[model samples]
Target: MLLILPLGISYLLRTDGIATDKYIDDRRNYIEQVLDTIDSSFSAYEQLIYTTVKITEELAPDKAEHEAALKLAFSSSRSALVYGIGIWYEPYSFDEKTERFGPYIHHIDSNNNKEEITYFWNTPEYNYQNREWYKTSLAAKEGEISVSPPFFDSDYTYITFGIPFSKEGKKTGVVTVDIVLPQLQGYLSDYNFSDFSGVYLTTKDNSIVFSKTDASNAAIEKHAMEGEQPGLFTDRTAVYDENEITSFFEGIGQKPEILTSETENGVFRIHAFLDRKAIFLNIIFRHSLQYLIFFLFWTSVLYLIIFNSSYLKRNYENRLLNTENERLTEEIFKRKEAESRLTFQAYYDEVSGLQNLNSFMEKEEALQPGNDNRSLIQVSLNNMKELSLILSSTIIDETLLAFTTRLKSVCPLETRLYRARGFSFFVVYDDQKTGSSQKLAEKLQNEFRFALRLGSRDIRLRAKIGLVYFKDAESLEQVLAMSQSAIAGLDVADSGRVGLFDHSVQEQKARHVVLDAAMSQPGFISELYMLYQYIVKTEDRSPAGFEALMRWKSSVLGSTVSPAEFIPMAEENGLIIGLGWFAIEEVLKAISGPLKNSGLFVTVNVSPIQFIELDFPDKLDNLLNQYAVDKNRLKLEITESSAAAAIESFWQIIDELIRRGYRLAIDDFGTGESSFHRLYSMAFDTLKIDRSFVTGLNLDERNQEICRSLMNIGKTMGSQIVAEGVETEEEHRVLREIGIKYSQGYLYARPQPLSETEFGKS
Candidate 1:
């Protein structure tokens, strides 16, 4: 009996410890879940606030439409949020004799002649200056938005999101909407988790935006509304008055954790006494379900002892026999009984009805890995977006399904197929011993190219294949990643041709990454121009005249690169904007100081796309004024084709440039869609004939006619004609005979370094 008592007591303690650990884990999980829920809800509130602000800033303002939209948002939101939307207008400051502060209102009634007046009945009581929301919103620049700390209002304290609506280039007024914390708390209270107690929402700044506990008294409310006190209180563990409120600042910037404490209302270390008792009594009293089941079994055994000994033994033996008989019966019927429980999930892709990611994973595990000679091929379809535009949704699905079916026929039965990501695929070759990787790539390309040709002419489908030799990989992930990198590199190279990866592919890929980063900066083009000046023109002169030619200086390869190389790269990556800005700024700066007193003009080439900028002319004017440079010393050169292509907007941009006292020239004339009609209609100060026509004028009759015609056309259009690319005295004489007085070429100066007096004698 003594042994039994001790063993039972030890077992009970062990069981209780296990139960306590489980309870703690469950409680921790519940707390984390509550926090996640609140964070997600708050994120939704923020998105809505930003969205409303953006919409209002765009709306045509009688303020009527914006007000109606706000009303709609307020009404449609979750009921627990007391004020879904509110607009705060900066009030007319009497002291400043201007509108410098704000008045919170539900709507704006401009027709009542209350444009600058704060409406008393419809507006909130608190002055806007006293609120942090107003200060923070105003402090933010135009297009900036912010969220303020939660505080109580005269009506009700709720968490609020603030959005500043300003004129396109100015930040002046703001609109703020409150999302009541009670609503979020109410939504969270619906959780039926057995372990969760309360949820708290705090900002990164450690201000509590929402909390379930009502810790406010009159003094606390006053302090909070006055924005004088911090949002959180600090303690290890505490209880207040007879209230069950438990809060503290324990784990601030990490995962939330449980904190145990015991203190009471204004004065009591005495709660520690109760904690000790709780620990002593309940520490070993906790139990698990398994222990409960064991206790029930022992109780049944004890009850059996009270019955007639022989009779009870016989009854137990009979019960054991019946249980054995039932076990045998279950074994006999097992297969038949389990028939209804079996199920299989259908594997289908929503877009193409191909096998999905889950199905691929299951099949991949079942397949045997390929041997040393095998190559894993990955195929990615290029220009999927263009394909989507040309083909209908139904046709796209049908085409993909058909393509997959065709691919299956070419693939071996053991070969696995998967639609990896959108418009991409992976095929592992188990039998690459018979063929080389290159040969396989060629065969696959030929077959797909043929298939795509048969489909449609309006859209073209091409495959980029990346292969990995399985021998180098220790894991599937590394092999897959290497293959993808190979494919991406191939896409960049050959520009529409199929590329094969080799030893030097890594260096090529790294070069591209560096190039992208360097080109993203604003000064890439200007730096390139400076390099060009240093290399091609050895002399450096102040107040010098020079023509700005487009050149590509690669950030990837720290050297002067060819335009043929980087121009395509710039176009592909949309770095043209930065490049254009750099060119214009370089030209302006050159003219500002180098040509200030030299009587020289700096000419720069401009692209058709540059004219689309609405503020381009204004920006140019600002730059010129800032440098105190003469606008007449700056000239913009545009190709004839570019000007003719966008004719309607062409004259407007050109007229603005001319009106600003800058010169405009039609470059590469007689080459692109340049005609007498175009020259007569459009205004330009100069016409530059193409080098081909100028250089061949002495030998070829056709070239001479073109040069003479261009000169005639320039004369009729009230523009001076310049002949370029003159290489010999004969060519120069031919241009002079054609009446092209402004001549530039190797025959004259070979575009020599612009000395300070290069254009001073002209």
Candidate 2:
């Protein structure tokens, strides 16, 4: 038993020795990492200090003789530097008559202080004779630099980096920069260590420049409290004594590899103790080696268990992996099938695998507004209607297919065709000037003439082709409607060869003779003024508080062309920007005067094209200032479709308007494909529910839910909510109940001229 006990003890001793060595090695690595972190932190500090100095020097160029030095500093490629970036000097009063430095020095706080005259210098009252830093810099020649020891100057002790200024060969003046010691000290103080550790900056003479020392705790006290220099002790044991100073560093020259030499910017050195005692203790107690010992013990045990179970585990894992692989394969197959289905559905029309309604609309919408000059020709198959009446449904289907193929041959490659319900067809034709609607009508007439002439033997076909040139159409919808109307007229016309519907033909004739006269009204803003004062300014919530837009009213026709009609005309005529400026100014005037204390804001709907004017901000600013109204009290309403067209410029305009104090609200909120992400990015201050959404509230829960979601989103994204098209009191009450703060509709008042009564009602 005695022999076994000694053997166990020996084994334990050997294991402990190995663990201690490993611990020491791990601790060395950890110390190195900590030192590296400290080095990086010091480097950052140097950069911050240099940047601060350079920034100050740039800002304070008026300081005497510093501008040239700063300009040189900026031209350098090196981003980091210690000194030579800036020079700091005190302002001194010199007496020419006395030819001496002043006896009294004015303090930085503008207080006068008196002190005995220590010495005098060449620059009159500039007392440079006895000052250490001044003397050190003045004595040093050009291309030489010196760092002064920390000294007291008016209750504050700070360090200085000084270099002598030279012209040609001789020294002219001393340039110096003050260093904040406490800032550097505080920077070093951030590193906490209970184990014995200290940071110090020193000079070549072994003088301590800065040190981490506690005056109260002698055990952790600094080696030197106050002294001319530091040197090695006689006894190593006395080194730890509180009274005796143990030289922390041998000398700057003792270690040349670790030591750095002085340059124009001053020396930089990084050194630490390699044979410190506490560091050895820290190494022996390192946590990693202890963890490693336990890790190896468990790992050896785990390996044995794993070895025994390897075959069974391997078979189980293989089966699991195979199952996962099969599932993945099935998923991939299903995904491919779904993708093919989606691809087909995206392009194919639901009813017949041809172009869909969306395709036709997209083509029409994509046409460039002014330059295209495209003409639309809509052809309705009259024979199909007759076929539907006389033949079986299957026979009618066959004839419709044959008719589509024939139409495909005649239609241009760029033209879009839609299967408009049962027997009607819609087609859009692009720019072709010489080929008049008459020529198209005659061509279609000829194509059918042969079909009709042959009857059953030759394949009879008869239809009316409605033609409308888009030169006078106000919008895509207008053009589409006109074309369809022309086609509708032909659907009932006498059975014959293809012919243009008389309405479009008559409308075109009317548009030509009266088009200029129709367009010859006052510009959009001139009408906007009338609209703002009368129709748009109504208390009725229909277009209630909203600025109603004006359309041209012709005395002869009795029908009015809407603002949606004339505004685009105004833009095409190059008058929209001017009109936009006028509206903005007029709104500002109203908001600043009658609406001043009413908590009421004026909103003017602006065309996106008006933003192209670079002086929009200047005009807005002028109007904002002229009215003496806060910019926030005015709003600019922009349509979502227009905003999306010029999104980047739209954002810029919105940003500038906001910066100048005006609010922006997106008009027609649920009418476009404005994604929530896009809405979030826009950061609009207000959202106006589109009239369609408001009108659909009672009928469509989906519409109501969408408006509700938008209102919720607006609240989350910091926007005020407004709902338009409230014709009934129920609509107004419903909107208010849904947290909509503002509404514009017929429930309140129709737009009328603003008066004392109008103001009172508001």
Candidate 3:
């Protein structure tokens, strides 16, 4: 018994050390995951700020232009994390016209539960040029983005991210975006942590950005400043030293097992503290059975030693051994059950009771090269969002479960089903079982045609299915991405559509990948240039004005990409915003330079994405002011489809643009629905007939009558009519007979570079 006591003590010490190490490792992993989330959020904000800087740096340093550009930039990319965004110029640096020129745009939640974007300019009293964020950003090395430490401001804490903007090799200003600390805290709160665990995020200077503890920030900072050693489980058994660390633990009233980790950039530190008592309790609970078993074994050994009767001792030993064995078996079974539960939670969808994307990825990874022909189909419910708005969350969950059950019923027994994401499922099957992917996709679509009964409601759902066949030689990631692209290519207006990732889809995806990469490269926009096509009067074939059409000649592709291809790609990828700005500036430059004395208004096409921006009119005014061009000289052409599909806000933008002295034209007028109603609603300056109608006007009497009717409608509405795609003399004559005043097409002259056009030559 004396020897056993020492051995037991040694075992307890070893077990305690192992448990402490394991706990530390587990907490470290948790901290890492938390850091990952924080990093991802921060990265998104960084990209936004970077894009804003890129847009702001090119502005002409006018106050109105800066205000409009800053407002537009902030509003277009607004995020929940951002409190505000601003531009701070050096003293008398902006346009060299003022001592201070800082413009800030931020959101204000009004009493009516609506967000209002408020704009503010720096006053003499509030000189933002002298602020820490601005000064630090200006002092930073060229091209370096600076992240300011959290500071208290206006009843909230904020961390500012700023990048210095330069003009002609000299730093002239700083562009910054501010993140609200409480919003960050809200993000962190989404993660689940132990009740006894506290997490704190701090800057390198030990200023707390967020803390889960009840201690005040000042107390935490003071404790950190006193040089408290940050280590994993350092002195884990030590009690709280009241005199030395009382302030830090004033609220907790207990010692903490602290673990600290710094971000890779060393900008921020994460401190995770577990209550020492809680840690010890958890450790004891985890190993109590092992300790009990050890004690029982020793007790049985002593019992055997004390008893000399062979039969009685044997019986007693057998019973004790059997009891210990049963307990051990039970413990093993419980552990296995826990492991199985964890595995299910990791790889299976909780709502659908099916395997998840992780399991699908694992299956994909395990596929052999010569395996049977397998096809992957992704089925996505198209109306989940609409249904969610009208139904309770419980109903939505029930609908998802019902949908998955129906999907499983339709799929072959040999098929493997996976929950890809919300209301989306993936089915994998070999050709032998499903016969063909097309047949299976059709069957699934047919199944969704029937109404699903849920309690008292009959819910009808539409699905989009994207299928891809693979021989296991291709990368599954690429296959999956292709499937997604195929799904995206399906018309949103259509329901129950099935698409295959065919050669055309593959080519389009490749082109988009290449275009996205090329556009991301520095100075890629320099490869883009504008061509001018003459808009001539139909009566005399005399040039009235020109349409500025953007063209791109990619050095990377060794060919010129047609606008038909890249424009849609640009719109999809959000590069259209930058490209739209480029087009505006280029057209204004041409009007103010080469075509200054021409007395002709150059029309620029405005994409719906750009036109719908709330600050579109203001941005246009800014550009016009910067270039010193008359707003009337640069016409904005929005597509008829865009106008027809526009909401009430679209009219507001159009009205504002017209109020600011810009002429608006509806391009491709005849192609959209309800043309007469749309024309009657707004006072458009010009109407451009679609190319399709004008293409065969000379040959088809129906097209000629259509063109004539459209021209009459435009004339009746006091709008000038322009006929497009007049390729020959006969088409031009037909347009003239139809009383179309303006015409633009190959018949006048093929679109030519500015230098080769009459305006540039003059």
Best by lDDT: 3
* CA shift of 502, model 3, Å: 5.8
lDDT of 2 at 221: 29
Runs off by more than 4 Å, candidate 3: 1-30, 38-468, 471-527, 553-581, 607-633, 647-662, 673-684, 737-739
Residue-level lDDT of model 1, residues 142-256, one tens digit each, is 5445656567645444555676775555553576766655444335445543222223345433344433332335534554465533233222111222122222211111122
Residue pair clashes in candidate 3: none
TM-score of each: 0.43, 0.35, 0.51
Q: Which candidate is the best by TM-score?
A: 3
| Positional deviation of residue 309's Cα in model 2 after best superposition, in angstroms | 99
Ranking by TM-score: 3, 1, 2
* Candidate 2 residue 245 C-alpha distance from true site, Å: 99
lDDT values, one for every candidate: 0.56, 0.53, 0.75
| Per-residue accuracy of model 3 over 1-762 as CA lDDT, tens digit each | 749956995788577878877877887888888886777667767777776776665565556666656666666564656778887777656444543456777657411223434433466767676677778877877667787777765545688888887766677788888887765655665566654355667765555676554444565555566776322112221222323333356434556677777776555677777666666666777878777777777776777778867887889888887887898899899999999999998899988899998888886655454564888888988677556545777998898899888888888798999987666788887887658878898888778888889999999887888887766335777667877876878765545568876677767767789988887778778899999999998999888999999999999888998998888878755688889999989999999999999899999998866766546777777878888998778888988887776544456567777777778898988888745765676678998999999887889999988988888888789898988888989998888777788899997899998899877887
> How much does candidate 3 score in TM-score?
0.51
Model 2 RMSD vs true structure: 36.7
